[model samples]
Target chain A: GAGVSQSPSNKVTEKGKDVELRCDPISGHTALYWYRQSLGQGLEFLIYFQGNSAPDKSGLPSDRFSAERTGGSVSTLTIQRTQQEDSAVYLCASSLPLRDRGRAFFGQGTRLTVV
Target chain B: SQQGEEDPQALSIQEGENATMNCSYKTSINNLQWYRQNSGRGLVHLILIRSNEREKHSGRLRVTLDTSKKSSSLLITASRAADTASYFCATADSNTGNQFYFGTGTSLTVIP
Candidate 1:
């Protein structure tokens, strides 16, 4: 693809419902990351996937938040039993390896609204 | 947790004026990067300053890093209304390892 792509640009769901977000990273990029940004807040680190190695799940806020990257190209973020406080924009970015100075390209992001 | 903190949460300036924003971090870093976001969409990488380098310039953007003080500054010369967006600073700590911690960001609005 020309750039990173995210599905379901906007999602509105009632509380306790499960929601899934998808991200397709730029080709040949080996590093993928997920971030959450609440209204009027900074970007919050969520998870990181690099190549085939085990993902860095340290940033996942809770057990309900989980992500998986298949074929090192596409990724998905799932939230079980969503809460109103989970309403925010979920962003996905990909980089060329995990270099200290590598630039990350971001997707449009999914705005999830838990009602 | 966020490692960088930007000062002046919001700034409103007229076009053609020089706009400067400051960022401070608590730990040593391998590099610091600046990014811009329009509305709440995707982020655009603007500039990056390595810890070894004290200053850098690209086009109308100038970035300075004072590693000793654990702080950095971004100066946008001759700002334009199109520059209206949220500017964020992200820091990567070499010792602590991978990932970048983003700052709270500074929202700049340029009035034409």
Candidate 2:
């Protein structure tokens, strides 16, 4: 893909339901990141995947939130038993390898609304 | 907690005036990047300055990084209404280059 791509631009799920958001990064990029943002608020780091190394899951809000990157090209963020407070835009970004001075390119985020 | 903190939560300026936003981070960083978001959607990368570099320029955007103060500033010269957006600063930790943290952004409104 020419740019990072995220699927299901908008999602509305009932509380307690599970939701999954997908991201497809640009080809050859070695780093990917997930972030959550509320209405007009700043981005909150979720997780980071770098090459074949272990992912940094330090930013996941709770045990209900989890993500996985497959084949280093696509990633899925899953939220179990979603709550109303989980409503926000989930943004995904991909960048060049860290050794090459990674500069992030973002995708149109997935806006999740838990009713 | 966010590594960076941006100054002036919101700013309003007339078009053609210069707008400057400041960002401060706590830990050592490999680089700092500025991003702009419109309509609460995806962010567009504006400029990046490395730890060793003090300043960089791209068209009307100028970025300065002061490692000593762990601070950076973005200046937009001759701003236009199209420039109205929310600006954020992100830092890549020196210890973990892949870990990126973003600060509370500065909302800029340029009046035409």
Candidate 3:
């Protein structure tokens, strides 16, 4: 339980439905990240959360993608009106603040499948 | 957009051989990190090499960074069957707010 933990390791959703993936970071890490990896593809940056600063939504693919971190520890990535293209392995990572080097610890990830 | 791109999309070698993967980035980076992922699993952090560092080693993993070339490499020595996985290089740019962009990755298969 020392590393990042993700719930519902796999989820299947109907197209147009909503899905929320959860991530629990290592207790003291202040920087959390969300990324997606499509089948046979590389990881894609989604959003970033760091210690109360504004969440970086720059990498979000569309308005349907959103994420929030509460109390700087647990985070959730929500996708509304999901399309087939939204299917991917959603990964969460946490690390010491950006200042303490960029090493990150990752969770098992939630594999989201939209049909 | 992805900032890093890896070369030789896939590699296969016999156990006890060495495996190397290279990555090239488009922008200046503060640090580059290597990660490994077995099929259907989350990424496992391998090693990180800062821009200021030329080379770093961790166990059987060795990472090297070349700021001038805007590239990095990860080397795994004495590969094993369990080493079969995908390897990716992520870059943290100098002023990109510390958000890391990942590379396409190289799928490595170390056969016994």
Candidate 4:
């Protein structure tokens, strides 16, 4: 792909329902990351995947937030039992490798709004 | 725990003026990167400075890193109205599997 791509540019879900956000990173990139950003707030790191290694799940806000990367190419961020407070823009990025500098390419983020 | 913090939450300047934004982080970083976001989403990588390097430049952008003080700054020279956007700084720590922590961002508005 030309760059990182995220689906469902905007998502509006009701409280208690679950929502899934998707990200397709640039081909051959071995590192992927997910971040949540509230309006006018700093980005919150959620999860990260580096190659076939176990994901770094330390940043997941809660159990409700989980992510899976299959084939190390595409990723899915699922929010179980969504809450109003979860309303924010979810950003996905990919880099060449785990040690690559801060040159990650970001996607156009999926705006998730829980009503 | 967010490692990076940017100053002058908002900045306004006329086109052709120079805009400088400062970022301070509280950890050992291998590199620091600056990004620009327009319309609240999609960020474009502007420049990256390795910790070992003191300064780097790319076109209209100049970046400086002070490892001892754990701070970095981005200078946009002769800025244009198209440069109006929110700028963010991200710090990458190698020991942490290259995880990055981003700052709240400095909103730059270059008026025509």
The most accurate candidate by DockQ is: 2
lDDT of each: 0.92, 0.93, 0.90, 0.92
Clashing pairs in 3: none
lDDT digits (tens) for residues A17-98 of candidate 3:
9999999999988999999999989988899999988988989999999999989889999999999999999999998865
What is the DockQ for all candidates, taken in turn?
A: 0.75, 0.81, 0.75, 0.77
**Chain B of model 2: TM-score?**
0.97
Residue-level lDDT of model 4, residues B68-93, one tens digit each, is: 99999999999999999999999988
By the lDDT metric, which is better: model 1 or model 3? Answer: 1
Q: How far does residue A85 in candidate 2 sit from its true spot (Å)?
A: 0.6
Steric clash pairs (candidate 4) = none
lDDT of 4 by residue, A4-105 (tens): 999999999999999999999999889999999999887889998998989999899999999999998999999999999999999999997647553789
Cα lDDT tens digits, model 1, A1-115, are: 9999999999999999999999999999888999999998889999988889899898898999999999989999999999999999999999886464678899999999999
Model 2, residue A58: C-alpha shift (Å): 0.7
Q: Quote the TM-score that chain A achieves in each candidate.
A: 0.97, 0.98, 0.97, 0.97
Candidate that beats the other on DockQ, 1 or 4, i.e. the better one = 4
The stretch of ten residues in a row with the least summed lDDT in candidate 1 chain B is B92-101
lDDT of 2 at B70: 89
Provide i-RMS per model in Å.
1.1, 1.0, 1.2, 1.3
lDDT of each residue in B6-101, candidate 3, tens digit only: 987999999999999999998777788899998857999888888899999999998888899988988999999999999999888777646888
Predicted chain A of candidate 3: TM-score: 0.97
DockQ-based class of model 4 = medium
Best by TM-score: 2
**Model 4 ranges off by over 4 Å:** none
Model 1 ranges off by over 4 Å: none
